[model samples]
Every structure is written in structure tokens, then in C-alpha cells.
Target: MADQVKLHGNWLSPFSSRVIWALKLKGIPYEYVEENVADKSALLLHYNPVYKKIPVLVHSGKPICESMIILDYIDETWPENPLLPSDPFERATARFWIKFIEDKSPVLWGVFLADGEDDREKARKATLEVLQTLEERAFGDEKFFGGDEINMVDLAYGMLARWMPVIEEVVGVKLLDPDMFPRLHALAENFRQAAVIRDNLPDHDQMVPLFKIRREQLLQIAGK
Candidate 1:
């Protein structure tokens, strides 16, 4: 029998998208099982007993949890169209940016979920600062964080490119303005148009409405 590969993922999750992108880039044929995070399935729990999260990559019945870990595994397993750089120094640099984004991603989410004016403003500012630094330092004039083509680091930061606008609409704030963040905005647009990214991206039309509703629900709970 062919190697049975399955991915447990939600349609809207950027975390899940990470796994999807890796699989697609590697030309891996796998079954995608839509997982409802709210009322998670027993199978998901069985696979990822510790986290109980979506994006459990089940390869030959063994599960790999966590989006980044899954990406690393896919890269190592496939080796074709490599995502991480070959050079140790370059690989370390890519890992550094990936770690930075992972650590700071929560602060960006706070811009959507923050209740009070003070908190919202602070979160928004921090998020903007993060974007500015990334544009200046990471990409600069290169096509991607990895330079020339997309890589693991590029995929890691790709959410900001596509989802930030949807988030801006939902939150009623524009963080990645063309005037203020020209390079960042251009980079986002560039990534969105890339062949691999374009084909693999989530449906923004479907996501914007869901994110809007989710943001409103969160705001209500926070008494915004």
C-alpha cells in the first residue's frame, strides 16, 4: 500500500496552512481531514494527546504535532525543493527569524483581541514595529526572507502578508499602510502572487467574514 499520509487541520488556521504549504511544496499527496477545533474529534486527541490541536500530520499512523516541527520534518523527509538553506549560517539566520515571528505572533493577535483603547494602541504599535523591522531587515530588496524564492522562513511569515489585511478590515484599523510600509506591502503583494503561495493560499473571501465574526465575539467578551 502507498504510504498513508493524513493532515488534521482547520480551513482558517495559519498554523494548519504551514503544514499544507510544506506538503504542497514537496509535491506530497496526502489526505486532508478538516478538524473542528471547538468539538475536536477523538482521532485528533488520539494523535496529538498532549496539545489536542489541529495540524497533526499522521504519516503511516505516526503523528507530528506543532506547525513548525511539522515543517522541519517535511523538509527533512522530502529534501526536494529544500525550504531551509544548505549553509549552516544561512539556516541559523532563517531559524532566528522564524523564532522571532513565532514569539511575537501573539502580540499581533492582541491587536485584534485587545479590549481597551490603551491595550489596543499598544498592541497595534508593537505589531507595526515588528512589520517594519521584518521588512527592513529580513526581506529588504530580496524576493523573500530566504532570498530569490520562498523558504521556511518565508512560509513562517507569510500569514502577515495575506491575513493582516483581513485582520485590518475586521479590527477597523489599517496597520500595513502602503505609505508607511511600502516595502512590506509590496512584499506581501509579491508573495501573494508567487506561483506556489498563490495556489496554496487559504480563501480570503471565506476567512474575512469568519475573522470579523470571531473578532466581534472576542471584543464582546472583553467588553470592548
Candidate 2:
């Protein structure tokens, strides 16, 4: 049996993409069930009763919620092209950076959703500080966070490669400057060129207009 592997996810969510990339990298055969966030499926609700979020992986009637957790499960179950390092310390380091992005990615999103000049500026500064630190610390000299191979860290932080540009367009701000964030720029280019990622990524053209609409809704709610 192939364990009846299936994933519930939304097309635009980077969290969902993380699981997709991890599964694809490991050559896992699975089904992707696209979820409507507005009207979540009963199966998703039952599987993830707490958060009711997507990117839930169901295997052999066992449901695994949360994107990173699903990625870990994928790594353990498949075990061919591993996503985490075998060495304990290296594994911890990869987990560390993944957690870092998971915790700090919100600052960037807050900036994107922010309205009013002062608030947006504050959020922008915070986002810049986080990006600056990541540039120097995580990506300073490594080709990828896992070094030469895309790993959990690279997949976790991949939102910066695609969605940041979408956010930049929606917010009408330039955060990923080639001069200031050269390392990030190069990383984004590399991620875009990756075989699995290149083929599987969502269409930016379709997403841009949708995100533009989302941006306007956020702005209107914020009274901009």
C-alpha cells in the first residue's frame, strides 16, 4: 500500500507549498486536495479541530496538521532524499532557522497589511531588520540553508522568494532591494530556477490581481 497519502491545502498559501515541495523532493506519490479557506471541508475541520488550518497531511487514516510537522513526517516516512540533516547538530540548526522564519515572517506580512504612512513605515523598518539579520546570519555564505541542497530551512523561508514580490507589488514598497539584500535576491533567483519549484509554483500573474484585491480590502479595513 502507498498509505493513502493526501494533502489538504490552499493554492496561494506558502505553508501548503512547503509540504508540496518537501513531498516532491522526496518523490512521494500523494493527492492534493485543494481547500476553500472560506468554507473549509468537513474532513479538514475534523482532522484539524484546533486550528482548522490547511496543509494537513493524512496518511493511513492518521492526520498530521501544520505544514512543518507534515514536512517532518514526509522526511521520516520517505527517507530517500532526506530533508533534514542526519547529524543532530546540523538538524537542530536547520530547525532553528525554520523556526526563525516561522516566527518572523509575520512582521513582513504585517507590513504588507499595514495602512497609514507611519504604521507602514514602522512595519517596514521591522521587516527590514529581520531580513538584514537573516541575510548576514543564515545566508551569508551558504548556497542554501542546508548547503548545496534545498532543505527544510530553504523550503520554510521560500515565501521570501515568491510572495515577498507579490507583497511588494500590493504594498507598493520595495523591500527586497538587489543592493541591500543581494544575498536574498540571489537566493530567490536560485529558488525560482529549482526544477521542482519552478514547475510547481503558483502562477504569479493570476495571484497578483487577487492579492491586489486582498490588499485593498486590508487597506479599507484599516481605514486607509
Candidate 3:
């Protein structure tokens, strides 16, 4: 039988887009299963009972969970177009940056979800601190985290390029100011300009309305 590959993901979720970009970059043909995150499907639950999240990569009969983990699995399974670095030290460095962004990502989300102005300001400051670390340490003069071409590190931090804008718009903040984060601003523009990512990105205007609604809903549920 031919190899069977399927991705269970939500269109709006950057985590889902990470796997999608990796698969596309590697030229891996697979079926995409759109997930309803609000009311998750039983299949998604079955595939990932621990996190019960989207962006599950089902290869043949096996299921793989977590966005970054799924990306690694896809990289190893289909090695035609390598995502990580060829050198051992370089690959480890890439992994380290990936983990750093993954850990700090929730801080950005805190700004989006914060109810009051005081809370949002605190979250935003922390977000800037995290971005400063990425700007100073994780990234350099390279066009991409992967150097010239986009790679797994770029995909891991895809939110900085794509979703951060939408989040900023919906939340009413200038999070990635050009003057403040010039390198990241340029990085965001470059990452989005890439053909694969540009074509696959969720519509910005479309996301604004949806995320605005979601932000309100989240606040309401939290009794904010």
C-alpha cells in the first residue's frame, strides 16, 4: 500500500500551520483534516489523549502529537528536503531556539488574553523582554533562522511572523514596532513573503474579526 499521511489541524492555529509548512516544504503530499477546536473531534482526542490538541500527524496507522514533535517526525520520515541543520551542533542550536520560543510563546498570548489595561501592560512588557532575547541571542544577521532558506526553526517561530500581527490588531497594541524590533520586523516580512507560507497563511482581515470575537468570548468566560 502507498504511504498514508494525514494532518488533523485547525486553519487558524499557528501550531497547525507549523506542521503544514514543514510538510509543504518537504513536498510531502498528505490529506488535511480540519479540526473544530472549540468542540474537538473524537478522532483528535484518540490520537492525542494527553494534550487532546490539533496538529496531529497520522502517518500510516500511527499517530503523532504536538506541533514541534510532529514536525520532527515528518522531517525524519521524509528526508528529501531537510528542515533542521545538517551539522550536529547546528541542529542542536536550532532545537534550542525552537524550545526557547515554544516556552515564551504563551507570554505573548497573555497580552491577547489579559482583561485589564494594567494586566495587558504587564504582559506586553514581558512579551517585549522575550522578543528582546530572541532578537539578541536566537537570531542574527541571517535572512532566516535557517540561514538563507526557511527551516524548522523558522516554522517553530512562525507565529512571530504571521499570527503576532493579528494578535496585535485584535488586542489594540503595537507589539512588534519597527523601530523597537527592526530585525524581527524584517524577519516577519521575509518569512511571510516566502511563497509556500504566503500562499498558505490564514487571511489577516478574516482572522481579525474572528480573533476579536474570540478575545471577547474568552474574557467573558473568565468573567473579566
- The residue-by-residue lDDT of candidate 1 on 26-94, one tens digit each, is 899999999887799999999999989988998888899999999999999889999998999989999
Ranking by lDDT: 3, 2, 1
Highest TM-score, which number?
3
Q: After superposing candidate 3, which stretches have Cα over 4 Å from the reference?
A: none
Identify the superior model by TM-score, candidate 1 or candidate 3.
Answer: 3
Model 3 CA lDDT for position 206: 95
Task: Give the clashing residue pairs of candidate 2, or none.
Answer: none
lDDT against true structure, model 3: 0.90
Whole-model Cα lDDT of every candidate shown, in order: 0.86, 0.87, 0.90
Tell me, by lDDT, which candidate is best: 3
* TM-score, model 2 to reference: 0.95
lDDT of 2: 0.87
